[model samples]
Target: MKLSSIIFIWGMLLCSSLNLFAQQTDFKNFETRESTLDERWELTSESSQGTFVVVPYKPIYILPGRWSNRPNKLPTSLNPDNVAKIPNDYNNFEARFQLSIKTKITSGLLFGKGDIWLGFTQTANWQVFNEKLSRPFRELNYEPEVIFNYPLPSDASIFGLKPKMVGLALNHQSNGKSLPYSRSWNRVVFHAAFEYRDLSFTIRPWIRFSEKFDTDDNPQIGNYIGVGDATFVYTHKEQVFSLLVRSNMRLNNRFKGYADFTWSYPIKGNLKAILQVTHGYGETLIDYNYKQTTVGLGVSLIEWL
Candidate 1:
């Protein structure tokens, strides 16, 4: 998307969130927990270097054999799979890391009601089992986002839904690769956090900025990755449950979506046992057009918010 368009949409969301901020009420039903349910308003002390840490957004893990329908993509020159192309090796590993450009730190800034954070996350699909090819990288998607969050009064509703926090972000996501396999896009995302007792939900809707012609790698990316995604996170004592639904706004003939279901339990301080299930397209930029279902289980360092 063009840089100018991103700026324009960001400005509008900022204004809308600010106006809505004044109307939200305070929510106090669920006491925040350390696992996956960190309170958005939680702040750092002045004595600390309060910038947030980013990088590892999802808990870094290795899910061996992510079995997918299509064969993994490899550069023609690397022709390691002898056949040059065949069903994707059903024995690769999936791993991701998010680096902190100061994402973990949380300090009050901007209107003194919100915190600013910068973070980058990279998800890679690897062909680790293909020993002949020395295990090559099939795809790596990069996500860098600048987020500004404002705590809304947790007491009231905008459209009958209690709002807990509001956020605005400029996100750029791309696979650092070339043609026939390249993918990239930018968006301005607006989020509203809500809670009703133990049920907490986040509604995130974004506007993909206008891109110059011939620049869109995946013209119908929104149809796969979706127009927006909503996350529902619930806590039962120390157990955390989450469901993420990303879907096209479905403006008639154009509609597609994905669903991710996760169940996590505390394993140690900040560490949790995690199992993730996903079904649909856009699992990654390279698989933006491939539909598949995959299951992964591993230790999690962080929970999706």
Candidate 2:
């Protein structure tokens, strides 16, 4: 069997089990207490306000100086037409920014405990310092997804960790360019959120939908970007710290992955001073197969709770 097929089956089975566990569990003894994940998704009646209200989905930040050790100048792909003939005149130091938002679409489904949400995230890299070639945007990625979230019982525990929620999402990501610069992919992502006092963990395993061989932009994207990722967030007083790890799950000397660490300290009001360090592939859709290390310092308006 193909690795992709195996991964798809496993994800489906795991989601099914989660659904069964949710259905069979007794919620009569479960309290209405809220956790960070609960508040983030508005699980309880106290947090939710029906639908159509916009909320932050991911961290929103602008890094004026995001320096990369190595930038991908010549992007190559399996498809001949998608390969860049001339190396791009990209600056090692560029400005990076991300904007993400989500809105609740509807609620009350599947035993009266499910909500759907629509989310959009946009990330961009601007070559503001490269004046010789005329300053231009290096890359832009757009991600839009639809998620169905099922909140677990407040008292639910799985393997010593408090299981907060389980969800499934249809995700589409693209660079929105033409020909050699274009890149896009679709995925079915499974989500599980857990907490353990002051720290929260989210695991997302995804299955990439196949594309026609001739038209596929990044055929080996899964090998570089990985099939899943895990995020851990820790809050200490007015400071928040996070780590994200991604792996292709390959063995025998063909391993590929990515990891990033971020620190956000409150500056004033809702503003935060943010520092981020990342190493590995897939920092952006255009850099999916390109590996590099980067450091970014910026201000953030919101962060993962």
Write one digit per residue (lDDT tens) for candidate 1, span 123-148. 66765445555556777888888877
Against the unseen true structure, what C-alpha lDDT does each candidate score? 0.61, 0.84
Per-model TM against the reference: 0.72, 0.88
Model 1 TM-score, all chains together: 0.72
Off by over 4 Å in 2: 1-34, 158-160
Model 2 root mean square deviation, Cα atoms: 12.6
lDDT of 1 at 253: 65
Q: What are the RMSDs of all candidates, in order? A: 12.6, 12.6
Best model per TM-score: 2
Lowest-lDDT window of 10 residues in candidate 1? 75-84
Tens digit of per-residue lDDT, candidate 2, span 147-258:
9999999877767789889999999999999989889999999999989987899999999999998989999799999999999999888688999999899986789999
